[model samples]
Target: MSATSDAYRIEPVTPAVKDYLRLRQQAGLSPFSEEAATRGLAGSIFGVSLMQGAEIVGMGRIIGDGGCFYQVTDIAVLPEHQGRGLGKRIMSALADYMQAHLPATAYVSLIADVPANRLYQQFGFVETAPRSLGMAMKIGAPESL
Candidate 1:
């Protein structure tokens, strides 16, 4: 949906556990087990979803220790809805939340994957390289269930 269209709306609500898993997968993100999602999402500080009627077509979340550290993550928009500015809508809501709720000195960060990093730049996110880099490792079994 277009940004000016009334057909789409962004809501300050955490997605259902199933929707979280599904949206991430559909958006080509890493897979999370039901157990992992249940535990992880329960700790979310804030989240928002883009809805076209009742369907959640996009999502973004801030998940981290609520005090000194916060990470902007879980950004995903369904493949069919990618180019209509939905990702920006999700980030706009997240940015608004951070601006309103976060402490002045809170450390906010995000790991932007390739092309998506460009969209993040519009929201004032800058790259931190030659000093610190984003890193990750998969836990548990080698194969996903």
Candidate 2:
């Protein structure tokens, strides 16, 4: 479906903190506490919300320092809203933002999950595995060390 079909519209506004958290959870992403989510949402460089009337059904955001680095994160669509190409629409908006605002030398990255990686690849995201693997450690979580 088109990005702005009769059923939905993509708004170039960050989802409210409540909607952000709800979308993340409903879309099967890891949960974040309200305090953490509030701080994180405030730091979004750019974000979009997929709206169906008054309700937010999907979202995506880019976060990083304004110049050298950025990460496409929090891409999520409601389960009932999946299979409608909304994810591609969300990424298209993000790609447009990156092209228009980010520097040519800037490094944009995202940690794609499973089949969603295919969607990201269409946007020119390549696997960095074998050269530099992605790694992470949650704060306050038990460390391997």
Candidate 3:
């Protein structure tokens, strides 16, 4: 692992379709078929992946219309490398990108995975209950309810 506090680098995902699929699978963060990732890679309004040497140790993505709203999605960190605050690094990068580029009240958001919600809150995310409820429509299990 070439990742250190100093060497960690994050940039918007490139055409590294293979690396994205591999790490997302290893992290148990829902595997994307190679073609799906390649397609969605282009669909991303914004995204970031943490690279150390040739390995993608952390990743996150944003999906939405670029101008008015966005949803932060697909956040993952390799299991072997968890608990080092790498997810924070990923989120920080994403948040910075949002803050620098989005307009006032642009409404960036994400569906946090429990404890990960804490990390997001530090970066100005919050739970909105009465305002709205979060819902999902699993692609394969359309009638999952």
- Tens digits of per-residue lDDT, candidate 1, 1-145, equal 2444367899999899999999999998988899999999999999998898889988999998898999999999898877878788899999999999999899899999899999999998899897888876578855552
Model 1: per-residue Cα lDDT at residue 121: 98
lDDT of 3 by residue, 21-135 (tens): 8777888776667878888888887778887767677788878887888998878888877877888888888888888888887888788778888898999989988899788
> In candidate 1, which residue pairs clash?
none
What tens digits encode model 2's per-residue C-alpha lDDT throughout 1-145? Answer: 4344558899999999999999999998988899999999999999999999888999999999999999999999999888889999999999999999999999999999999999999999999989999888888774641
Of the pair 1 and 2, which is ahead by lDDT?
A: 2
Error of 2 at 63 (Å): 0.2
Q: Report the error of model 3 at residue 4, Å.
A: 3.8
lDDT score for residue 106 of model 3:
89
TM-score of each: 0.92, 0.93, 0.87
Count of steric clashes across candidates, in order:
0, 0, 0
Local lDDT at 81 for model 2: 85
**Once superposed on the true structure, which residue ranges of model 3 sit more than 4 Å away at CA?**
1-3, 143-145
* Pairs in clash, predicted candidate 2: none
lDDT for 82 (candidate 3): 80
> Which rank order by TM-score, best down to worst?
2, 1, 3
